[model samples]
Target chain A: MALAKVYVNYKQSILNPEAEAVHKALKRLGYGDIEDVKLGKYFELTIADGKSKAEMDKEINQVCDKLLANYNMENYHYELVETEAAQ
Target chain B: MALAKVYVNYKQSILNPEAEAVHKALKRLGYGDIEDVKLGKYFELTIADGKSKAEMDKEINQVCDKLLANYNMENYHYELVETEAAQ
Candidate 1:
């Protein structure tokens, strides 16, 4: 079986409210050394089938492109992992 | 200034609802080599301080401990990076 990971994040320089809130809280807590913050989402999946690794990769990529990811303002990237077949 | 990253994931044995859904969808589309799925969250922050890297690390750790991370059913770890001081 293969594993896949999809990570989505706002592009750098884009102000992130989530990060900003955390930064503010940190400052209020007296650790005022932080300047900014950003957040990201991650998705992982295990692939099982009789297909080739390449086929799995293509399918995973499609999942990302179609539903698992949103590209309106966030950027999405993914990694495909191949593991030793189980005994 | 230092940069911080927090990565949180469900424990290995924990069943992930999000991942299960993705696995089923991939199966419906064919090319299903996936057996499971899991999800994670990521946080990044840019810290600016007159303090040393060690000090920043300490503060960031505190932030993690007090807030900024949810430890219930999730495990979190962080990395601290010191960037070249802006000239």
Candidate 2:
């Protein structure tokens, strides 16, 4: 099997109000040293391993573009690791 | 400054309906090679650097336990990196 770890985050130009709220809450909770907080989505995908690395990369990118991320506001990147096949 | 990347995910015993939904969606969207999908939360925190590595570790753990994760149903882990101090 292959494990694809995808990270999706808002674009730098986009304002993330949810992250701002979390930062405020953290400060109120006495974590005064936390200067900034940005929250994003993480996904782990277990894929059937029969394709080449280049093929997997292309497919994963297509998945991200179609479902995992909003091209206009968010960006995504993924890392693929080959794991032992399920017993 | 220091950068702390935190990842929070549902415990193994917990039923993550959302992840299941995503998995189904992926299949319906033609990503048939995707065997399973797991979704989680990721956070990047920029913190003022005045503490030793040990101190930072303790503080980050406290932050995760108290606010970032629900100890009853979720698990969290973090990585810390020393970055150039914010101007």
Candidate 3:
């Protein structure tokens, strides 16, 4: 099997109020050295191993564009890792 | 500076309905080969560079336990990467 670790985050130009709140909270909690904080989404996908790497890449990209990411505001990237097949 | 990428996910024993719904959605969308789907939270934290690795590690652990994760149901991990100092 293969595992895809996908991350989806807002574009740099976008404002993230939740992350801003967390940053402020951290400062209030005495973590003054923290310069910035960004909150995002993560997904783990397990796929049966059969397709070639190129094919897998294509499918993953399609899935991200179609479901996992909002093209107008968010961007996504993923890393693929090989794993032992489950019995 | 240092960039910390933190990932928080539900523990295996916990049921994640959102993730299950996503898996079903993918299957319906023709990604039948996708065996499983898990969703979680991701955080990117930028910290001023000064502390030793051990200090950074300890601080990150404390932050995760105190803010980034729910110890009862979620597990958290992080990767710290050195980044160029801000101009």
Q: Which of 1 and 2 is the better model by DockQ?
A: 2
CAPRI band of model 1? medium
**For candidate 2, lDDT tens digit of each residue in A29-73?**
999999989999999999897899999999899999988999999
lDDT tens digits by residue: candidate 1, A1-87? 666767878766566788677778878888755676678887777666567877777777777777677666678788877767731
Per model, kept true contacts as a fraction are 0.88, 0.90, 0.90
lDDT for position A37 in model 2:
94
Which residue pairs in candidate 3 have backbone atoms (N, alpha carbon, C) closer than 3 angstroms, thus clashing? none
Off by over 4 Å in 1: A12-15, A48-57, A84-87, B12-16, B49-53, B85-87
* Candidate 2 chain A, poorest ten consecutive residues by summed lDDT: A78-87
| Candidate 2, residue B74: how far the Cα is off, in Å | 0.5
User: By TM-score, how accurate is candidate 1?
Assistant: 0.75
> How far out, in Å, is residue B53 in model 3?
0.9
lDDT per residue for candidate 2 within B1-87, as digits (tens), equals 899999999998899998898899999998899998889999999989778989889999999988899999999989998898652
- Which ranking of candidates, highest DockQ first? 3, 2, 1
Error of 2 at A47 (Å): 0.9
Q: Measured with DockQ on alpha carbons, how good is candidate 3?
A: 0.91
Give the best candidate by TM-score. 3
User: lDDT scores for all predictions?
Assistant: 0.73, 0.91, 0.92
- True lDDT of residue A69, candidate 2: 92
Model 3 lDDT per residue over A17-40, tens place: 999998998898889988999999
